[model samples]
Target: MGWISHLCLMNMKRRKTRTFLTILGVVIGVISVVTLLAVGIGVRQEMINTMIDSESICQIRVTGATGGKHKDRMILDQTVKAFQELDDVDSVYPFYELYVTLTNGKYSYDGVITGIPQSELTKKNYTKTSRRTTSNVKPVLVMGDKTASLFYNPDTDQTYDTAEKKKAESWIGKKMDLSFWDSQDSTSVRLEVGAVIDSGEDTYNRDSQSVYCDLDVLKSFLGRLPGGGTVYGQPLDANGNPYKDFVYSGAVVTVDDIDHVDAAVKKLQDMGYTTENEKEYLDTIQKYLKMIQLLLGGIGAIALVVAVIGISNTMTTSVFDRINEIGVLKVLGCDPDELQILFLTEAGIIGAAGGVAGVLLSYGFKGIVDKIAVKMFDLAKGTQIAMIPWELAAGAVVGAILLAICAGYFPARFASKLQPLDAVRNR
Candidate 1:
């Protein structure tokens, strides 16, 4: 073997501890990169899945039209009819909403009241936990759990420290007093709660301190005929009173197959309907993923830069320690190119070793992270963190080698340029 090649091998063996430390530094950096990327990807995928599962895979929301500046009834009717006639359209359900104050003795709260047709419930796939034995025009009302809980346990004091036991007791079978305001007057009604429903979504469930009753009851309570007359262009009562209109906040459209969601959304949109699907959520997630990748990569890059400095420092020290040996080799006719190559090869060896260790450490790091996540969030059961992508792992190995070579360059050049007389005499 050449003198320089033999010397590099001996140097590495002689300083085993330093070599190990350098490898450890690189390992930490690589592990950081892998773990961060994997976790970010996992979180984004999980969020998208949750959103899609809660809503239908392919759904659209349509808002009702309002008369330019004033509330025009005719425009709203025309817009609704236009959408209903679309070629790819499915069945449509309309709703009416009102905000009112409810009171039971001393406890009171303001909540939204919605009027929906029975068929709309089935179309929307709402699970009915309870219902009335008989269907009367104005007898039954369905309420969300949050609304039920409020009436079931009302607060008596300003601090809400004491429970209004009597008020809570009175709400069970009593009709709640609901007051609404008209142009300049107030009207009131009493409605009985027929049943309670539970939907898992916390945001919707909590704010849904909502009461659902039949359209007929809602019309009567609003001081309108069963079939309200067209006040603007909307169907109103015999006295020309307008029906309270509700914009479709959202709709869950079931497709023949899950795979057809994209096609169905396109078809609906082509027919002038707004759609929500995997692509919409996925695009949003991709933006966050890109940000996460940059942040994680930047952090990992800083660590790796530190490791590069360490490598440079280690090589510089090695060259100094072996100055006399380098002088002896130069004296014996070791070429400058040979000396440079030898040092570069040693740097590459260190990088390759670090890369191997780093990849192994990444796998272990991912496992630990997954375990910690499980303990912290108790997310979807049996979810496991994954390792770095193969392409990324390969890139890490190559990048490490390149960084090491760059760090070793100046030190190796310094050694090569040293005169044999100067190196030997100085030591």
Candidate 2:
């Protein structure tokens, strides 16, 4: 072997501890960066799944306007007629909702009363948790588990008859008065309780305390039709005369295909009706996730820069210590370019070692993070922590090598330019 090659091998063997320590520093920095990116991607995927899986991705909601003393103004007949005529609109169901208090003697809690048609109810998969059948006479009402638990008494371990004194044997086949103020601010009729239904969703279950009879019952109570009408079952004109153009509060439209949600929404807007898609909310969520990923990746980048400085310092020190050796090689017929190449090769070796170790360390670090997070957050153990993308890993390896070469340049040049006599005499 040539003198420079032989010298590089000897230097590596003699400074094994320093070389290993520098490699370890670089490995830790790269591993941190990879792990952070992997976790961010996993979190984003989970959020997307949560948004798209359960609800109707292809559904759209349209609400009516409420003007002055007329709150259900949006439910006008003209609006429904126009929306129903839109292309690609599969089915439309009107909705009427009210807020009222449920009372059992001294105990009471506020709940929402909604009126839905049989066709819409069936399409939404609204099922009864307690009562199997809906009774027209009894006025069946479905309750979510949370709402059911609120009225539950620990002593009796039952809902209804607990401390509340309301004698509801079961949500099914029960009679209860639903008292609410009418349009003119008078207490309306007492609607009976019906079968309790379960939506199988947390938010829907908690918020939907009770959903009463179909739209017809709601219209009768409010003195209006599916679209807003008069208490006298007649339509009111702009001049306060009897008219026939009153509409309902809102409509829930179901589309045939989920992919057509956006197209359907646009069509409705063109028809002069407001349409909303679930993706609108998901897009807002994605914007926030992207910001978080950028912030986290930026933090990891600082650690990597520090690791580069460490590599630079180590190479500079090695070059300084071997000054006399380099001068002696030059006097013994070693070319100046050979001296520079030897030092550059040493820096490259350090970079390659670090890159390999960094990849291995990332896998181990991800395992630890997964175990700790699962235990602390009560997450399913099946959750996985992945390594950085292969492309990113490859890029990091190349970047590290390039950085090392840059860091070693000045030191390698200094060693190569040393006067043979001056370097030998100084040592």
Candidate 3:
């Protein structure tokens, strides 16, 4: 071993009790910081999981223009075409919803419907569970995975798991009669079920609980079909009229990539369109998350600061015990800087070792806490309350070493300045 390292080791070993106690203090401090940091990270992640990815990051929801030059104009085909040509735009889809009554023989049910182009209903991420089969006889529509449960034999129990589920499974390729009441009259038609979407595991997995039909087919049979879900639905127009040139209330504008959402949104806003993108809201949430993490870290820092004092105290005591040795080394021409480095290195080693042990223990403690939280709380299965990222783990060890070096500075300076005559006489 190098002389400096050897001297540091000897100095620390000479006061094994004090060194061990000092290390213990550092370990407790590190455990407190690392575990709390993990908890903060975990909570922030959970919040992100709950709020983010619920909608497409690159898609924006746009309503009728109420500002700029296109004020008070209705959203229509031209608007979709205009949006599609904007910079970074991938595609734009115009859609309208309806509260309608549907029937398969005697199984009549009330539900919601969306009229969108067939091109839109066929996109991979947007929709695509079962392949669509061609049939020239009648227009086809796709049903949600759960929509089948709405139509079932009345004589049998209407439970979703029983007859409803079995009957819903048989709805693929079947014909269903649909009716919509407009402002002036009622219109009806029959539509075949082209395919059924696979069940969604989450809440917002692309129309997983609704129905969608070709816009052209729906327009032919619709006459100012009411909007909204209530019995007294919101009317789209005052007079009953055909939807050959219907105006859309809102649209979904998709950007080519997530990196282009800002540019696309700017273009839309410049055109007097108001847009809402879930990704834009994430920045606001992240601001609050940073504040929470800072608070948690501050609480843990209290313990770590206390540990720094312990290191300082141990180094100062070691200096007094080794006065004679330090004086002899100086008389033999040892540099004062070397003595300082030796003390700092010794303290740093103890701090780093303590930090490593604490990190390992923090991981074990996290596992225990997570299990207890899952069992005692209403959290979903496999939920974690504490999570230590690799960045945090590496930082803790580095921080411990730096803090120890700082704590040892004063004692190292004191030892380096001791006069050989004065130190030898005192010994």
Winning model by TM-score: 2
Clashes of 3: 0
* Residue 181, candidate 2: alpha-carbon lDDT: 31
Off by over 4 Å in 2: 1-11, 67-92, 109-111, 123-128, 136-139, 148-173, 183-213, 216-237, 241-246, 254-277, 324-345, 384-406, 409-427
State the number of backbone clashes in model 2: 20
Give per-residue CA lDDT, model 1, range 367-391, as digits (tens): 8888888778765557764446688
- Note the Cα lDDT for every prediction shown: 0.63, 0.65, 0.74
| Model 2 TM-score relative to the real fold | 0.73
Cα lDDT tens digits, model 3, 202-316, are 4444466678777666655443334432222222343432233456657899887777888888888877777888768766787887898888889998999999999998889
The local lDDT score (0 to 100) that residue 282 gets in candidate 2 is: 73
Error of 3 at 343 (Å): 1.8
How would the candidate models be sorted by TM-score, starting from the highest? 2, 3, 1
- Best-performing candidate as measured by lDDT: 3
Off by over 4 Å in 3: 39-55, 65-72, 99-112, 123-199, 202-211, 223-244, 327-334, 360-390, 419-422
Mind giving the per-residue lDDT tens digits that candidate 2 earns over 136-237? 433345544345545543455566544454322254444455555333444434444444445554445222455555666455545532323355333354
RMSD (Cα, Å) of candidate 1? 6.0
Give candidate 2's error at residue 139 in angstroms.
4.9
Better of 1 and 3 by lDDT: 3
